[model samples]
Target: MTYVLTFLPWIVYAVLPSAHWQWAALAGLVVAVGVIVRQRAAGYRPDALIIECGSAVFFAALAALAFADPDSSLHPYSGALSSGVLALIAGVSLAIRRPFTLGIAKQSTPPQIWDHPVFVRTNTVVTALWTLAFAVTAAVLAVLAHAGQGHSTAATLVQIAGFVAPMLFTKRYVAAVQARSVPQ
Candidate 1:
């Protein structure tokens, strides 16, 4: 579990750079489901499931966008978002003050992401903000659609997926921190 948690951020970093905007989110969704199933099979409680799934899906989408350009061009919003996501990861790590020991899952740890009030509150607030961002973006899409504006709906979808990546990855970050304090 520890190794998996640690590598998730790296996975996001890798995937976002290579995927097209149109497919980043879809790819993220797939990644999230895969991780959730894996975590459940490993005997994680429901709390763990939420954190694991949310982060994986989020990171996958974000990753698809982050590395959208092989040259790592900053032209794309995905790249920008990816940067923000990385910053968030770093910030969370610093706050936790743990050097991040990987492979805690090998011991089959319990889900305790919500045990710390501060973490739980911060994560929840971030998730809520993410929801609001999604809503606003949806509104923008609806207006654009009504005005018959924009070239590719596919592209829009991909960008939206990129936005979701942060939220998902954020959740994963929270869960990983919680997992650190949880007993096996």
Candidate 2:
């Protein structure tokens, strides 16, 4: 899925040791570009353009920073920074009245319902949940990074739970709403 692909680089960066972080960052950039190319080739707008673009920018910035000062102290906070970027993207999407999830949701949604208030409202709520998740994840990661435990198992679990919780909620919430809408 697009979401999985988008997070591939982050996962790589997280799993790799600190010494190999530069390589991990580069790998993430490569994956992001590849995902964009593949999605475009399929005549589909990539599901998470904002996230992908943000990743590319982050990677590029990190690459430059590495080149400028290989020993920069900021390197350890990469995970927190990544989560913060995600939070920004989600918040901006909501502010612009174009929830990032709307595009992904539209891929499977019928054209007739695209303009429905319920459909729009559903995506808005889903987007808000995602925004909250990213914000909380960013905050937690920041705390972990400050404590010099960003790469600890506990931090990893928190990050995974942050994403998975909203994802599971979205599925269940949507299903429940749909079921309720259908006549008995």
Candidate 3:
């Protein structure tokens, strides 16, 4: 069920090149909000605030772009990237919790930190920073689009290009702070 919403945008991109990206982006939002609610309802207090914050920033940035131009420059890629940023944080956190590698850390307290707030803020900041990058990328694309150049049609391609270093760096840093020792 979730997988459909997760990859549908990409699938849509491949099959229907002429489709409006905003529609797929809206669909992705609906799916993400629904999943977040479901997860919260299931007693999974898995840092919803940070996710919400990141989502808000990402959306706000898109809204900025949308305000720039309703007809031409309002690309779905911004909103999609916004949604994707939170999705990546959530997905990575879940993967760490389940039957996966680094399971022991899911169980250790860091001696360097007193509470989760530090890393929670770190994750939030990381996501927000990425969201800013998303905005910059959007601006670049918009300019190029106005100039009649570049692949602005590609959904969040700029983000994927710029996201790796920050994501990996933040992940490793936060994991160091929050990972628990496995109870043997």
Candidate 4:
């Protein structure tokens, strides 16, 4: 799903070894930029690339920092910072009344139903779940980083679960809403 693809850079960053954090940051920047270019070339509107754009900005800055000072103190807490940034982005999207999921969903959903109450509600709820997930993941990762276990298996598992749980919720929630709207 396009929604999942938006997180590919984050996934890349998470899986790579922290000993080579600069490389990981560079890789994330490259992947984020590539995803944005690919989606744009495929005719996706800017609105549909909210996460992609945010990712590009985040990764570019991170890469610059990592390269400029490879031994920066921020390196150890990059995971928590990443999740915190994501939470900020998602939270701001909701605050502005434009859940990022709405744009991604529009790619598959018919335009006729784009303005439907159920459709809007679905995106809102899904985005809220994602925001909560990111926030919680940030908190957990912060604790781990403080304990000097930022790159521990527990942190990695938490990151994976954070994305997976919200993804599953989005899929099932959308399906259930669609089913409810169907005529008996």
Cα lDDT, all candidates: 0.47, 0.78, 0.43, 0.92
List runs of model 1 lying over 4 Å from the truth: 1-35, 48-113, 149-184
- Model 2 TM-score, all chains together: 0.90
Q: Enumerate residue pairs that collide in model 2.
A: none
Q: Count the backbone clashes (under 3 Å) in each candidate.
A: 14, 0, 6, 0
What are the candidates' C-alpha RMSDs?
A: 12.2, 1.8, 8.9, 0.8
- For residues 1-184, write the lDDT of model 1, one tens digit per residue: 3334534543443355333544554555566666667767876555434434445655665545445644344324443353344345434433564211111222343357434555545555554444444444445544443454322454356345646565576568757866875789
- Candidates by TM-score, descending order: 4, 2, 3, 1
Residue range 85-171, candidate 2, lDDT tens digits = 888888898999988878777767777997888888988998899889988998998899799887788788887887788889889
Q: Which candidate has the top score in lDDT?
A: 4
Candidate 4 ranges beyond 4 A from true positions: none
**Which lDDT value does model 1 have at 159?**
42
- Candidate 3 C-alpha lDDT tens digits along 1-184: 3223323333333233323444443444444455556546654334433343344344444445444554544453333444355446445544453211122122233535423455445544554554454456556555554555433444336535444545565567666654642244
Tens-digit per-residue lDDT, 7-47, candidate 4: 99999999999989989989999999999999999888887
